[model samples]
Target: MWPIGRSFSSQNLFLCLVICQVVVCMLFVIYRNTQSLEHRLAILTSRWAAREDGFDFPEGPWNVTDSDVVRCSDLINGRFPSEAAINRTIDAIRETVIKDYEFIELTRDCTKFAWERGYYNKPITKEELDFPLAYTILMYRSVHQVEQLLRTIYRPQNIYCIHIDSKSPPLVHIGMERISRCFDNVFIASNLENVYWGTINIVKAERHCQKDLLNRTDVSNWKYLINLTGQEFPLKTNLEIVQILKEFKGQNDIRTLAQPVEEWTYYRHVLEGDTIRQTTLLKTEPPPDKVPVHKGPFFSALARQFVEFLQSDIADKWLEWFNDTKNADESFTQTLASYPNAPGGPGPIGSKAIISRDIVWSSERLRERRPCYGKFVRRVCVHSWRDLVRVSKSIRLFANKFHVEYDGLVLQCLEEAIHNKTHNPPMLTFHFIDDFSSSE
Candidate 1:
């Protein structure tokens, strides 16, 4: 028989175990509730802050609570928080070892939160508009910046094809996939290219996206194609863009110049493997078929008919001819645009047919100049806020080279301007050809 004191001690131990299990379960429930509350608070705060700052929130079914609004005012202000601050907040909840399920859940939840706060709301109505369907090719390295750009230019009527560089980190690929899944109109390109500046592969990457977009069952709906790097930003809203594109009246907006091809451009060069990092100059040879070489930058807003022509047998011949040429991207499209046999060729329209981009150069000339603003890497401009301010006054529908991490303020201000319709209200009034003809 056990002693009475020992019996009581054993009973007490069992009671303690029961109490501990209950406490642990209770704590877990509390933790989960707290997480849910925190997420709700973050969204509410973002929305309330936008409203308090005199910013116009898009009309939608936003999930906001009276208690949340009162609490949010204390936490959030009008200014956009820096990227670092956002990262810090996310890191607290995100595990160091990112599991796929966790990542997906996080992505879905964050996207939902942003939507609830009015970030993804449509500011315009969908109607029987004659606007050309916009086909966008977005090549990106920075996932966050790409997300911002996607959100800023999103329209239900448009189709977006995103291409992430093959060499980008794994996280970038995952993030892009998650973001792409959020919208039915958005998708990742089937083929990813390892891109290099001044290399043929750069042009190939664009072509890959174009082909992917063209192959879609709904390709017939898209009437215009705009190729943009991750760094580019829209200076006009969807309504304004549609209005400006309508002015083109089926004309292509590509830049082409009837200038002699530079010796470096035509010279035979061999790229080391698939990369442009190492190239060996081969013996110079005349361009195939003695095709007259025209020069232009890569940025373009092309008509569907012109893009269709590019997929034809004749374009295939030109592609083979320029396959060995240096800096092919700079000359390939220009040559095709000027080729008389090609459909929708420039013909008598000449430079008027080309209105691809507004580039600010150091010399302020069409040729023989580098970007005037931002640090030039590989001759392309990484534009700053000051440059954005100066270019904001121009009639260009889109502007090149904005790095959000470098200057988030510019993008934030531009977003505000676009949403508020403060910048260039006259653009909506249907101004004439002269307003848009100025060289960048």
Candidate 2:
């Protein structure tokens, strides 16, 4: 038993804490529920994923984060200035406009750039800082997209190696170089290759950057190397990416399938400078020393050790064999991922999520396959605003080919989502897998 005044004061304190908690809960509910009906519907509709048609590239159900749903809702709820206007006008804000590099270079201040353009300067988690990843990015076009993608993924702990195609506009190189000057970790490749599509130059460009990044002593402790194209955008925040890569446990997240070497190296491709012309249908010999041949996606998350393996003698012979091959970019990293002698090599077929990027290709026969709200460029789908809900919910680290010039709202909304997740992590995070298995 206590004195009457003391007991009363203790009860009063407990009651005040309960009142404070209740008020906080009520405020949260009101804030979340105040959005318009249409916004609520957008949130509700995101539960069911876009349908995947028959005979197309199949995938399982999408995983939606509650945190992403709120951000998507806010984009549609007119919380931001973009959504206050009509949809077309909102998206058009960034579609046709290019960044003014002259103005950017005037100050050349990182603090100003980060405040103005919203780059995440500090690491979100100790896990991300301790396990810094390296990036080898390919860029030829879309100045705004490249800059925004870099802004979103930029971190002090990580290193970035960008390879601007030698044939690209001078402004492209200038813009990238000026931006790179602001950061010690990001740089242009020592040797820029005149990248030609469906040729070995594409592979060489990546090799140049890989070598550059590997040689850097400042960030030599980086755990993995993630390859990206300028057009792609990250679906996950940097911290989330760090979390998923840890799931791979030491294995590289490369996708590969055993294929005949003749398939890609079948024709005698003549390269006069950057132009490629097939003169004769003569198949090249298989990989040297009977090393296995496999093919899959060009982009992947490779362990640092696997990158070291690539500099070895046998790997040199393997790369040389593909020098004259068509679309060798698609086979190089993937084929090397499954080699028995390769360090961190998981047996063939490593392309499972591992939370890396994705490319959507729709076949002509199944034209209405997985709905790409964005128009199809060549054969691959370039994502647009309508895909925001889907893209944000994906467990993958990033999704490729977002044409910001077409629908800038998608990128804006993704930015909002990442900003929200970075500042306030979700109450429950998706349990990422260690590797593909019976359950996946």
TM-score of each: 0.69, 0.78
After superposition, candidate 1 runs with Cα above 4 Å error: 1-106, 109-114, 117-120, 125-129, 273-289, 347-356, 363-373, 422-427, 438-440
Query: What local distance difference test score does each model get?
Result: 0.60, 0.70
What is candidate 2's lDDT per residue for 238-350, written digit by digit as tens? 87677667656667777665674564566667787767777667755757777666777787888888888878787788778888888888787767766767777852222
Which residue pairs in candidate 2 have backbone atoms (N, alpha carbon, C) closer than 3 angstroms, thus clashing? 255-351
Best by TM-score: 2
lDDT of 2 at 231: 87
Provide the clashing-pair count of each candidate structure. 0, 1
Worst 10 residues of 2 by lDDT: 40-49
Q: Of the candidates shown, which would achieve the greatest lDDT relative to the real structure?
A: 2
